[model samples]
Target: MINGAHVIIYSQDAEADRAFLRDVLGYPHVDAGHGWLIFKLPPAEVAVHPAEGSGSHELFLMCDDLAETIADLESRGVEFPDPPEEARWGILTTIRLPGGGDLGLYQPHHEPAYDL
Candidate 1:
């Protein structure tokens, strides 16, 4: 029975990346020092390695507005691969995370939280 887990981002630019996550996206985080910064991420419905420029799993965050989320992320200096695209499953978008990880932002087709 698993309760909680933390996703770690290994970044070459640790401090700047941490600041980006905290200031731009407004995610709460704690600096542990020694090349590690911990971000208080939301509950995980899915998991993946977000490392950019490497063969890694994709990370997606379910958001309210696909366009707004994209815009906000862009404004905060997050690089998106492309514009939002709607698919049968959800609205898929992309962003470059602090640890050179690729972030996929999506809004699911069904309201899982509401249903459960």
Candidate 2:
């Protein structure tokens, strides 16, 4: 039976990234001891899109309000390298993470599947 999913982000500066996730993003977490932190994410979902050629997987954090969410994160010292772009799917932009990484965050235009 399929259970929940666990996503891992490999970071060059793991401590800093953990700090960013804990302090800045404010995702409640527990230490696995020795400073290893496991964060609890908000509700999540997965969708598959067909591609022509082989492609890698990607992760995106979905939100309800794009502007408001961006404002809140920005206030927490998060950086957005590009402005949000509107598409049929949603409004999206990349949020800069520690160690020169980025995470995809978007406000979805489609109906959420949380009820299912």
Candidate 3:
């Protein structure tokens, strides 16, 4: 039986990124030996969308209110590369990670399946 998912974010500056997640985002985690920290995510859901090619995946952190969430994150020194924009499914924005990568953050207009 399936149990859980482990998500990996490849980083150019891993230590800095780890500190960002730990100190700024405040995601609970355990030290998995040798200073490797594994974060515990909120409830998750998976979806499949048609594409012309394969071997690609995305990660998005969802929130109940995008405006409020953005404000909170900004106060914590999080940077958004762009403002939130509307989509058929949600209002989306990109969070700039300390590792120089972007993570998606969105407030969904469609019902989420994480609770199901």
Report the number of clashing residue pairs per model. Answer: 5, 0, 0
Compared with the true structure, the alpha-carbon lDDT of candidate 1 equals 0.73
The order by descending TM-score is 3, 2, 1
lDDT of 3 by residue, 61-83 (tens): 99999999999999999999999
The TM-score leader among the candidates is 3
Question: lDDT scores for all predictions?
Answer: 0.73, 0.89, 0.92
Tens-digit per-residue lDDT, 1-116, candidate 1: 98776666666776777877787878876778784667888666653545668665445677877888777777767888767798988888877767676667887787656334
Candidate achieving higher lDDT, 1 or 3: 3
TM-scores for every candidate against the unseen true structure: 0.72, 0.91, 0.96
Q: Which scores better on TM-score, 1 or 2?
A: 2
Q: In candidate 1, residue 76 scores what lDDT?
A: 66
lDDT of 2 by residue, 1-94 (tens): 9788889987778888899989998899999999999999988888899887896788888899999999999999999999999989999999
What is the clash tally of candidate 2? Answer: 0
Candidate 3, number of clashes: 0
Poorest 10 consecutive residues of model 1 by lDDT? 43-52
